[model samples]
Target: MLEISISSSLKDAVNDFKIGVIHYQNIVVDTLPPLIGDRLPLYYETIQLSLQEHPVSEVPGVAEWRSIFKKVGTDPSRYRPSQEALLRKIKKDGVPHFVHSAVDLINFFSVQHGIPMGIYDLDHLSEPIQITIGSDQDSYPGLNGRVMHLSGKIVSVDRTGAFGSPIVDSKRTCVTEQTTNALQIVYIRPSMELEEAKQLIQKMAEMFTQVHGGNHEWKLMN
Candidate 1:
C-alpha cells in the first residue's frame, strides 16, 4: 500500500483540506462492464438535466474546488477543476464513449458526487507520497501530453516528483490497460463531513471491485 501525507504548510493554508485515497490491487482493467455501459444513457440524461438547472460554477463541489484553487493561486475559471471540466464536456457532448473500466468508474463517481477524482497506475508511482503546494519551478507532462505548469498549485509529489492534482494528473502515472494496482484520489469538499467522504469512497470501492475484480482499501488523509 502507498502511504500519503499532507505538508504542514499546505494544511495551514487550506481550510478543511482532506483527500480520500482508494488503493486497489490485482484489479482487472478493460472495457466498461455491462452494468455501467448499460447505464450510460440514463447517467447522461440525468446529468444534463441537473446541469441545465445549475451552472457548472454554481455546483457545490465545483464551487468548493474553485475556492481551493484560488487559495492555491490558480484561477479556477482558467484552469477549471477536473469535475467541472467533465461536466462541461458532458453538457456539450452528451454520452461519452468508454475509456477503460477503472477510468470510467472513477469518472462516473467523480461527477456523481460532484468532486474531482483521479486514478493513477500505482506501479509507476514512488511510495511515501506527499500532498503539498507547488512552486513556480514545478511541472510535469499532463495526460493530454501537454506540459502543465504547477506554480502556486496544490500538487501530489512522490519521490519521482509531481504526478497528480485536483485539476489534472500527470501522464507518468495515468492508468493503462495492463495496470493491476491503482490509486484513486478524491478531492473531498470542505463542507462535506468525513463520514460522507468515507461513505462515498466505500460505495465507489464496491462498484469498482464489482466491475474490475479487485481487493481494495481506503483512507482519509488530512
Candidate 2:
C-alpha cells in the first residue's frame, strides 16, 4: 500500500494546508484511446469560461499557492501555478495533444477543477513519503534535466529526495509509458473546502478508470 504524510516541519510552517490524492496501483494503459483526447477540448473550454471572472492569480485557491511560495522564500511571480501555466498555454496556442491517457487524464482534471496537480510513478518513489518545506541546501533534478533549488520551498520528498511540488514535479518521478501505478496529488488552496476536495479527487478516480484501465482509491490529507 502507498502511504503519505506531512512532516512536523511542514505542518509548523503551514499548519492547515491540505492536499487531495488519488492513488492507484496495477494500472494498465498501452495506448490512449480517442475517447480520452476527445473530451479535452470541451473541458478546456469550460475552464476558460469559468476563469474569466477571476484572474488565475486571484482565483480562490491560487492566492494561497502564492502565499505559500512567498512564505517559503520564492518569488510568487516567478513560479506560477501549474493550472495557470496549462490555461495560459491552451489560450495562447491550443489544448496540448498529450502523449498518453495518463497525462491527458490529469491535465483534464486540473483544468476542470482549477487546481494544480502532480502525477508521479509510484514505482519510482521511496517509501515513507512526506511533504515538507525544502531546506536551503536541498536541490534536485527537475523537469527537462535542469537542476532546481528547493530551499525553503514546499515539496514532496522520500528517502531519495524531493519529487513533487506545487510549482512542478521532478524528472526523477515523472510518468512514462512503463508507469503502471500512479500517485496523483492535487494541491488545495484555502478557498477549497474538504467536501469539495473529496469530490474532485473522486472525479479524478472515475475519470482515470474511464480513460485508462485503472483502479484507484483516494483520501484527503490535512
Candidate 3:
C-alpha cells in the first residue's frame, strides 16, 4: 500500500505558506495509457515558447533556477535560462542519457503543464512522504551527483531528505524498471488557484494512465 505522512507542523504551515497538494492514495497504483510518444516533441516546443515569452520570474518554482543562475554569477536578465533552456541544452550537449518509460512520462508532463513534477521509486522511500518548507541547512543530491542546496523553498521531502524539490530527482531514489512502486509529486504553489491545481493534477493522472497503462489510485489533500 502507498502511504503518505505529513508532519502536524507541516500541515499547519501549508496555509501560511499558501501551498497545497493533491496526493494519490498510496495503495492504489493505476497506470494510464501513454500519450508521451505522440506528444513529447510538441510539448517540448510549447514549453520552450512558454518560457521565452514568460520570464523565469513569472513561472512558479523557477525562483530557485533563477537563484542558481545568479549564484553562479550569471546576470539574471541576460544569462538567466529557464528550466526548458536547461533541458534543451542538456539534450543538445549529449549528456549521458537515461531513458525509461517513467522518466519520459515525467518529461512530457513537465512540458505540458509547466509545473515541476517528480517521480520517485517508492520502495526506496520511508513512510509518510510529505510536503513542507525547507530548512536553512537542508540539501539533497540531484541528477549527476549534483547537490541541491535548498535554503528557502517549499519542498516535498521523503523522510531521508533524498528527494526534496521538483527541480531534480535524487539519484538515491530515482525511478527505474525495478521500481514496482512509485511516488509522483506535483509542486503547487500560491500562484495557482486550488481548483485549477486540482484540475491539472487530475489531467496529469489521466495522462499518466493514458501513456503508461496501469491500475492506480489518487488522493488529494489541502
TM-scores of the models, in the given order?
A: 0.95, 0.88, 0.67
By summed lDDT, the worst window of 10 consecutive residues in model 1 runs over 92-101
lDDT per model vs. reference = 0.86, 0.76, 0.55
* Model with the higher lDDT, candidate 2 or 3: 2
Give the C-alpha lDDT of model 2. Answer: 0.76
- Which one wins on TM-score? 1
Query: What's model 2's lDDT at 19?
Result: 86
The C-alpha stretches of model 3 lying farther than 4 A from their native spots are: 1-35, 46-98
lDDT of 2 by residue, 1-222 (tens): 467897787777676778887888788765667666666677677666766665777765566677877766778787777776777666655574566778777777776666788899998998788888887666788763678778777788888888888777798898888898989888877567789778877877887876667688888888
Candidate 1, residues 46-162, lDDT tens digits: the string is 898878878988988899889998987889988889989888988887754458878877888888888998999999998899889998777999976789899888899999999
Candidate 3 lDDT over residue span 122-156, tens digit each:
77878667665467666777774778665544456
Error of 3 at 106 (Å): 1.4
With candidate 1 superimposed using the best TM-score fit, by how many Å does residue 166's alpha carbon deviate from the native? 1.1
The candidate that wins on lDDT is 1
Off by over 4 Å in 2: 45-54
